[model samples]
Target: MSKLFDLGLMVRTYRDPLAWLTLFVDLLPIIAIVFFGWKAIPLVALYWLENLVIGAWTLMRMLGTIAGNILNLPIMLFLGPFFCVHYGMFCFGHGIFLQAMSGNDQGGAFGGGPVALVEWALGTAPHMIWFVAAIAAVNGVFYLVDFLILGGYRKTQPIAEMFSPYGRIVTLHVAIILGAGLMMAFGQPLLGVLLLLFLRVVFGMALNMMRRLKLDGGLPKTLDPFADMQVETG
Candidate 1:
């Protein structure tokens, strides 16, 4: 009991530094989108949703240490789109709301066309460059956050002291590339989300497993397997 209590404290403390870092890192893309001049609101919206989901996941992982709300595969899977849509709405609505408040025509001048997009892109090229730079600079936010969150838990154990949430995100890019390749190869994008969700679950489970085995050094051999199984698997 004392051991468990101490462990919990360590995990919580380790997450503190990470939380501060994460808050700062989280602001970059938003700054990029706004300052870089959003060519299409949807792209900006995507970044916002992506950032939000990552933040939520980080928070949940921290809370899980004591609360044990360890998100299983299905929850992350379902929440992916929900998070995206939620963030999209938030970004777009905020833009429109501000525009309306300032007395700009509700649906003025921005036509939907490559030419318009290109023109907007050219106008914001410098801003877009800054946005891209910001993204590159802060790309490691997720991994750093994950590492700090888990590092908190490994405070006393043989557990790996560092793991990056961003590291796991590699799987996301890989999935996107692979999905795009498949779409080009076979001409279907329907499975992209499903594949991405599958990868997220597998990646999450792998991280947890690594933490358990590499970081925490696995369950004690003396601990009864049957009882442990009952606790974790039952």
Candidate 2:
């Protein structure tokens, strides 16, 4: 580990085009909200969509980590099916709830029965296509930032290194949910949007700090992946 933080390195790294693009991708949601107006998109729906996307992404990363470290097999065995079933139900249930809240008639789309319920649940995919695409783009940019800019290939970082992204995802979701709640309570969704933008900036900084710490070997050598699981499950 370096005795001192290298400010020069930080400055030079941030000046790279990939770094700039990463920042832009990180800020995309805020930019979109500002451009379209806060209420133009459904805040709750967007948050739920992000939850689904992030959950799936986390599962994929966990599987990749497991592939690299056979010792992680036990954790993978437990979590793989768990997350799939949990997130599947979570997404479908929440999608239906949101549709109901918006007064979208799913029954009419599928002839009004239990079959219709199943159809509506499955139908969330089509409805979420654009939001899912936007989130996938953001995640793709983050992957580039991790691999190309953040020394992911320099040496194998611990699975715990994945925590930073997970933390950011959770934080963004909470900020949006709380902000939207406040907006409804006080009739100021624009204020909520501004709050989300501010939180995104803070989240970006937090991620940068994590990357720097990893570079400096300041991060723990091993962190219990179970701890991460607890955070997600709780």
> Which predicted model would earn the best TM-score?
2
In model 1, pairs of residues that clash are: 11-152, 11-153, 36-127, 142-166, 143-164, 143-165, 143-166, 159-215, 159-216, 160-215
Runs in model 2 with CA error above 4 Å? Answer: 1-13, 16-18, 38-41, 87-131, 144-170, 181-186, 220-234
- Candidate 2 residue-wise lDDT, 1-234, digit = tens: 131246764675475564565466556655446564534135445655665666656665666565456776787677678667765665555555555655675455335543454444334433345545766776666555654465343333334533423444456557757776877888976777677667766555444544444444554342222233333335
Compute the lDDT for candidate 1: 0.38
Q: How many clashes show up in model 2?
A: 0
Error of 1 at 111 (Å): 16
lDDT of 1 at 130: 48
Per-residue lDDT over 81-118 for candidate 1, one digit per residue giving the tens place of the 0 to 100 score: 55445544443444333233334423542444323333
Task: Locate the minimum summed-lDDT window of 10 residues in model 2.
Answer: 220-229
Assess the local accuracy of residue 208 in candidate 1 as a C-alpha lDDT between 0 and 100: 32
Worst 10 residues of 1 by lDDT: 155-164
List RMSD in Å for every model shown.
17.8, 6.6
